[model samples]
Target chain A: MPTWSRRSPPGWSWPMAEKKMVDVFSDVERETAMTANPAGYAVTELGAEDERIVTLAADMSNTVAEFIAKFPERYIECGIAETNSVSLAAGLASAGLIPYIYSMSPFGMLKTCEQWRTDVDYNHLPVRLVGRLSGLAMGYFGTSHYAVEDIAIARTMNNTVVLSPGDAASCVSLMRSTASLEVPVYIRIAEAVSRVYDEAPDYEFGKWPRLRTGSDVTLIGHGMGLGLCAAAAEALYEHDSIEADVFDAAYLRPYDETALLASAAKTGHVLTVEEHSVAGGLGSLVAEAIARAGLSVRLGQVALPDKDLEVGVPADLYEYYGLTPSNVAAKARSLVRR
Target chain B: MPADITLERGRALTEAELLRRADWVRLQTIDLIAQAGLGHYSSTFSCAELVATLYYHALRLRPAEPNWPDRDRFLLGKGHVATGLWPVLADLGYYPHDWLKQFGKVGSPLNDHPNMKLAHGIDFSSGSLGHNLSVGAGMALAARLTGRDYRTFVLTGDGELQEGQVWEAAMAASHYKLGNLVAIIDANGFSGAGPTSQAMNIEPLAKRFEAFGWTVREIDGHHAPVLLRTFDELPDPASEEPVAIIARTRKGHGVEFMEKQPQAWHLGLLNAEQYADVVAEISARMELANG
Candidate 1:
């Protein structure tokens, strides 16, 4: 029975310790911070130029305190009610405002999924949805909070653009790109990622961003898995003498069929990586597209198992789910050697 | 006229004129529904006078520009009621009357529910029950944030209250002090299954809204003048609360043989006998009111 104050002993906060562990991967994690999450922040940045930019959140304004500090009027905290937060955002869009809604991934996307599909997607309103700590990032919190199937559910909706930025830099870039889209966009974020890609190539909303080039095998990763994929590819060259191609399918819904087809043609073997469940996720989408196009490529997926996850540190969970560099590297080696 | 049920002097219209307009809208809805051979005609017929009063004398709107930011937003939560909504939109000049001829047709914007894309005057797409109230609250909140005078009004079916999400939104609307948002529950005592009371009694509906911190009003929904006045005279939400007016109405209000008949809850190809009965009843009421 201890009070949760900032003055508490060093190890008082589990989330704080969790933050430290994620920092070890800071080299790559920092590359994927969210661009337009907590709609309050994104709207303030865009509202200066576009009067239509507005934001609504599910009583989580304190998480994006800086945005609220800067633009109090634009931020709305619906006090822990995710359903109202979504419905309100739809209403704002109907009133001619570009609305962005922010909430935890599970509640914001899954819990209010029907509202998202019927109210926003069906209407094709420019309502931006930002989901934080997606996938197993909420590992310690258990099933109710984890957004493991967000990508799978969102991809099924028509006229929806799903973005999973690998690092903070890409998060910001993707945010600015998808902000002006006429249709709804779902942006999944994993804060403080480690890998930072070179900013030389311009980022496109629906096009996959290539982080590393290789001819022997193709490693596909979305959102937080990009760094692991890159590390895995590098390890393949160092230990096994196989040059693996690392492609970031930043946008999950509109899978880059052309890039995927071309890479499959070059490598002949494809491996998709993500922190989401294997069922109906990025891997399934890729496999379906490759099969449809009649492409002769061996497709493989490295993903979290479909079940309720146990509580633990994020790194431990990531490692357990075969998302770490070592596991990813091993998977790549086996695929290329096969 | 009860002084309390009087509309603003300038906007008020004779009950005969309102009833005539409502009847015309009803005829248009019947034609469209019959042509489509599928619709929520019974539910829509029940709300005709209420919608007519609001558009003509209550809500501030611009049919020419449906997306006018300053315009008042009207959300139809009872989506099954869309079958009747088509003609009302046309009568308001939101679209041509001919457009409704394509109701339920493939590629026609007019589906069973109101779609802002296919037609004008609808603020949001609502066929899924218990969603429009929150959207209206959002519009009202947006008005407050932007410092606009526009208000938001939502009309939902009594059965839709069964959704837990509706109460969730009801609580949020009151918490935000959305005085600019007004909810009108069409308590016609019927739902998809049967009588709303039998399905689930929502008695003391006004008290339920009042308990959630809303200004409450109960009135006969078919009375145009009373309906218009209720909208006009809505209390300032009595200390920043939202407003809810429980509209007491019959499931099939205008047409005889359909009213209070659970079997007539939703009409199918109106048989010659039933159609003749409805036509005779409406003609008699139209004459009595006209006289």
Candidate 2:
């Protein structure tokens, strides 16, 4: 076998992502006919097989126009009432129809948190709540639109499944995964996370994707934080001679901890990364897993700080919050060093 | 006086017979609450006639087939009054008589509030206020979509109207023009702290609902015969307008002490002496009605 080389192959880093923090998805967006709105396409695809599927939104007809175009009679427009939309979805579910309640993240998941808990969760109904424009994706809209605490709020509901897909294809497939489940599902989706996956990977409920492998550190990322990990793996190998095992923790609730823990046995350190509050997010889940299993390995977490965020573009916000690939790699290096 | 059991509408019981049924429900409710040593009797007492009329006459229910797809749906928005409902279900044989004595006891499915998962007769679980009407709206919509003639009725406490979700549902019902849906506000005037007016004034209730595109009607809720007639004559769903029946009522009507002292009766336990007095009072009413 040939010996490994520590040096760069040919000027790859170029100061490592100093290009532009403004429009990050521009490159991948141009090459692909992908969209951030995957629920519409998934509804169309799922409705072809199951006509019992209904779509209800809080005046989000344009947002879920695809479902309307496919089956106009089944779509309901509730006009900016998230609570009514959720309760209505519960009602629809009670009548043996699979209803998907769609809206912006803050309103859909956070605003209607009680309805999700009491009506849908307590009753054990299968209502797919799609919170698009998650994270700080709608950067200029301020805290009203930001949904950093949704995953924490959603995952606490018993018998509920929470998912955060990193790309367009994963989003559609995750929507498909929610259709057949008997319990409620809350999908936290980002508006634009391009270039994370070239082709759609096979989807399975309650299972995460182990994208890359290494011996030093295992990086756990969820939602758009996942794409960051996938990108960081390449930079870490080339520039720092560090190989990290990356995992897309799409299923945040009912998460299968076997693969993650097994990877930890091989690699001694685990660092959870997420674009959510450090308090009750992927980091908290991983920490719980580590402590519950009585593992002696070190656990590091890189996540958004527990504070109000500044209003700017998401890329700039990511940089300010130390979510850039360089900062991610740096955090990984610290975990390995520890 | 004893309720008159003469048929009024082809095969329907007259107003007096309906009132006797209401009194019977109220008597059962007092005993159930006194037995558990915990219940919202006022909440239950106020809706007696409304419940009695619907179960005995108005609603289309196959008691043997409680889960029948075409059966009318009844959602109790004020679930603290679930004690009043349990007896009705038992009387109809929705559940066994054994479960009746186990209310509020540990290991029993019965609780302080309605739990549909634990109980078979309950249509929707509704401890949280202001949500059931929206759920009722949903059922009404399902009836529309499925081409089922089943009507959906939601009985809400006047206090529960304070919750914003009720108005949201009100707007939604009007927007869809779900004439198959009917909302009866158990406007018993007493709420959590005291009289609802002092707590949150929801006066001009009829005009407010009418403004929201519902055909509003005000009636004496205790007049079960009148309620049955009203239920029979209400606008059909084909009319493209929802109905809101404002059932004007007293919190605790049948019993003297409870009716006079409605403030604390929202939730109260009867001591041994108080329990005897309540039983005696209801017995006197039944004795007078028997004459």
Candidate 3:
């Protein structure tokens, strides 16, 4: 088991040494202290504001219990069929109603890929597909419940927006902000996430939120990975005297290319951390951006491998798969050194 | 409320007129597919009366106002038959008649399948089978929630029932008690490969829907009077059970040669000589129906 180093590096000067460094690791710890699902509260609040807002659940009503309690008439229980729920949402959208369908991540996005392609995005309907317990948050439930391939599948859909919020506040803010979007949206939500913000920061679609600034390396992550990246950046600075910039890459599709290029130019090295597979998640998106711009910056990724993963508690799985802060920091150090 | 079968375009259509319209649908479909270079002729021929009756006598619509808030909605799950629907929408003035000449051409809205985004009157776009039933159920549920009295109709192919999502939608629609939703299965016997039963038997389809809690009605799809009466006698929007009408139809009805070999005619190009024969056959049928 790898552990984060607390000892400061000797005879190294921090570039932003004078600036007050926020304890990002502590912030992440605070964020993970949530007890209730933020999406339920956010959607409930949205239903109160917009009459068109309706929620459909596929045997996952607990994820949006608040919305169900507040707006029982608008809450539709589609039982356990994810494919039907997705198309049903599209049908509701066609009739000028805004619908949000909720399910476990794997079933919500991967199992209904065709429905999303033909029924929802192809029609350009405004349906919100909410996938809870993304990544390995399903823990011992194993790969059947895991959603590492969801981002890859969702980003390929035309006229669709892909969102992954980092913390409870950001999740709420993102849900509220994207309530009336004209195009379909796939929102990836973890069961629990570390705090990347003190409150709901103002969210802009297709833009990355800069969490911490540095000149040595850029660290990008989203959803559960954002907190890990923030903590990793903190560890890198404390142990190896490496100043790393951290960004919350919330939007997977229509990513913030300008910010990515500018950060790569400034830092010369980029590291992406995600709970998804390295093939088509945040790492691939960043790699595509860097390669498209013909940038000479070196890129490193700390993510799950492209293979079937084993079943375990989320913490043990994160440690084994190198999804912890220590693993991210080690990968960042290697990138900076190279 | 049941559809007002007596009035269409502010005038009553006689049974002979509706039968003539069905023949016209067959003729127009042949012309459209001949121009497009490729299409599903047998599939369109199978549901000619169902399409004609829905658009002419069964549906409430303001043709000039295609986006009427309370209008009846129709979805084509067996979307290959979209060629049969374009002519009816054009005749109703949904879009210009010239659009039909450009069918399947690049940048044309009239593709082989329905696209609600590109076309004016399509309630929902469909190509991949087994999705429109769920979509139609959603529309019906929306009407129920919003206090709207519009009915949603979905036409699916018999082979389309092989897709598991169709059953998923069937179970859910019945579970939700969506009475405003009606599913018309065009059981034309043949699919793209061969006969639907040989490929993947969806036999006892009526019993299957009934077991899922839908009110089932089996009818002869090619009969104009039966088609209109079935649509007119649909369950009320406020009823508890969804309705499924099993429309038993021939793969190809009017054209003699195509009727004999449905598998080969499933998708084919009609040359000028064959097109003339098909048009003449439908014309003679229309005249006989008129008499």
Predictions ranked by lDDT, top down?
3, 2, 1
TM-score, model 1 to reference: 0.90
TM-score of chain A of each: 0.88, 0.90, 0.89
Q: A1-338, model 1: which lDDT tens digit per residue?
A: 95577576776665555344444334342332233232334445676777677767786675566666766777777877888788888888877778878778888789989999999999898898888767867666677778889888999999899988887667667777777888998988765355456562356757887878999899998876887888888888898888988888888978788998899889998999898989888899989988998998888889987876766667777767888888888877778777
Model 3 in CAPRI terms: which quality? medium
Candidate 1 residue-wise lDDT at B100: 79
Query: Which whole-number lDDT from 0 to 100 does residue A313 have in model 1?
Result: 60
Return the TM-score for each candidate structure.
0.90, 0.92, 0.92
Summarize candidate 2's per-residue lDDT along A93-144 as a digit string, tens digits. Answer: 8777888888888898799999889889999988899887788877766788
True contacts kept of 1: 0.85
lDDT, candidate 1, B97-131, per-residue tens: 88877788999988888888777778888899989
lDDT of each: 0.78, 0.82, 0.87
The best candidate in terms of lDDT: 3
Pull out the clashing pairs in model 2.
B1-B289, B2-B289
Q: Best candidate, DockQ-wise?
A: 3
